[model samples]
Target: MTSEETEEVVETTTDSSTGAARITAAPYMPGKTFTNMFEKYATDGLPDVFDISFFGNISGSTIAQIRSTMRYFDLIDDQYVPTDLMKELVGTDEETRKGLLKMMVEEKYPDALGLSQNATSGQLAKVFNERGLTGATVDKAISFYLHMLDYLSIPYSSHFKKRRPSSNGGARRRAAKKAAEPTPPPVHTPVKPKVSTEEEQKAAYVQTLLDLAKKDGADADLQDRIFDRIEKALGIGGGPAAPTTTGGGTTDSP
Candidate 1:
């Protein structure tokens, strides 16, 4: 069968559990809820077997939400065992963990991330509310997601951060004035010219050959031949360039 047909079949089968039709009605859980679950699993240790009862005091629906989120992130395998990603997350340094989490969110929750980018919690909450999500639930979810962003040191809308009230209200007025002011046109800096040294030029030539080989579907033997020709032409590997006699003067053919 053709690759496209094979892909379509695989997608159709996979979608039986996690397809668009199924996802549309999936429960929405905030980023904070996910982080909380991760922390719980870390502290208590992820059980070898999946057990709804392991989540003490948490509702069955909440457990289901957590499980769905985990599955969506590919953190758990078909047998519910923690995947390599989950193990890496648990063993990695804080910065590495944050990077992994950020990547996960970008990959799995890009829509929500895009909505939240440069938007205040209230603005994000409004978007969810418009989509028929409960106000309280939306607020909680947005708050949690924002918290996750902060933990990851990812920059977001500055308006989301809490500001102290100015005693004289001067700071607020100045901020408003600044916002009202027209932005200045950006200045373009002239690029400095780069001069490639002899070694750099040789390196660039070699790279060009490699790129051409890749583009032309060169086999190992063809690539080796190309490299051999280059070496011989460059007088490398004890090979000297052929000398040409032009106007009774000898010059290397290069």
Candidate 2:
């Protein structure tokens, strides 16, 4: 059936207590043990009487508790025959079965189940004791019902398994080492000198003027004028060679 249909079934199915008092005399039965019993019953049908041998080599008292617990939940009839509810549960899907089980618990034992849903077994015991119910017996009953609920995938908090401590000591050491180490300084790249297009043009002009001045038969005065003009355009103060004497010596004051 669809989940919605299953939920409708659960919602419609009410308590079938038949004026019978809720079972509070049984010890807590593990969810797996109850599952085993249901599986066996589904195959072989309900037994004439509670039998420890049928379940494991468990105690006789444990067997009686299991039987009483089953009856209290209305899973079996007075004749020890599997009821219609048990029959329906036998082959239902997991989610549907859980829904049904939750509905059954809520309807049949509203007070105990409602209280257990929010409180621990010990805390629930105190509340039940105030109501004149045997605290220990009520505690065990709450535990058994809670286990069944858990097995059926109902949302209920229970004792959590302790987690083991991690053993990656080397990883922790490496992490500590990384944190303790200092950060390195950032790297800087050296800047290169740049020559502008204007400077390049001025250099070419100076070179060309010098070459012209060095040519054979070039006029000394003309070469001096060209050198002076080139030096001025290039932002330089020095002029070219001064006029030479007929003996090829520089004319300087003695």
Candidate 3:
């Protein structure tokens, strides 16, 4: 959890859970912005020194998603250098690209590839659910698979084809219920002085959310529903009433 009044920043992936240090797993998240970078790499050329500078003005979170997607697809080496797979993706013919993607789907996401074209979103989720995924965590993996299939012109369950609007249906109901039930007065929270670097603080905030999302995924949703809970809990107001879900946030992609 991030403190609105806090001034100190804790560096690195320290475990605040149960006092034991946690070993990490290979990163494999994909987010909405990942495709943008993957596409940009094909056009802009992945610089030899791959780092923040490689993606221009995008946020650090965006870069993290992009890197995670690359790693997930085995497109980049541990050092962030483009692998032969990625180079081939960038330069291959359309048919070869399809073959390469199919190979990846078979090897890395056999569960996703096995799904029937008419499967429902709930069924799609069940595939990940059985693997212990939940929330934006599941969204990341699914987003990557979906985008890859889209790029390959592969058929998938039409259930997952719809975007974020109708899903906001739940959001609207929650917003209304919250509006009708609110009565407590706001508790005035004391302000604390800033003592951390702006960028570092931003990174810390994002890392906290990412860490939380990851833990559950290891059972996830990203924006809208997930963020709505975060916003209400934080009492950060978008307006007098909750705002309707709008726009896309992040999704897993490569």
Best by TM-score: 3
Model 3 clash tally, residue pairs: 14
Best candidate (score: lDDT): 1
lDDT of 3 by residue, 1-254 (tens): 22211211211233687774322222234534454454666777867745666768966665665665566677776677888888887776657767876777666656666778877777776676555555555555566668777876778878886533224256778999999996999899999976655444434444555566556443324534545444543457452322222235323210
TM-score of each: 0.44, 0.42, 0.48
For all candidates in order, the CA lDDT equals 0.58, 0.57, 0.58
TM-score of 3: 0.48
Ranking by lDDT: 1, 3, 2
Ranked candidates (TM-score, high to low)? 3, 1, 2
User: In model 1, where do residues sit more than 4 Å from their true spots?
Assistant: 1-33, 36-44, 77-79, 115-123, 126-132, 160-254
Compose the digit string of candidate 2's lDDT tens values, residues 1-254: 42211111111223366653443333355657776665666677655543344557766566556655566567765544667777777667656777887787667555555654445545555544544445245545455665766676666535311212234476688999999999898888888978976566566566767888888978989888776867665668565433333344324311
Worst 10 residues of 3 by lDDT: 3-12
| Deviating ranges (above 4 Å) for candidate 3 | 1-39, 162-254
- Which candidate, 2 or 3, would have the higher lDDT against the true structure? 3
Off by over 4 Å in 2: 1-27, 43-58, 113-123, 130-136, 156-254
Each candidate: RMSD: 26.2, 18.9, 34.6
- TM-score computed on alpha carbons, candidate 1: 0.44
For residue 200, model 2's alpha carbon misses the true position, in angstroms, by 94
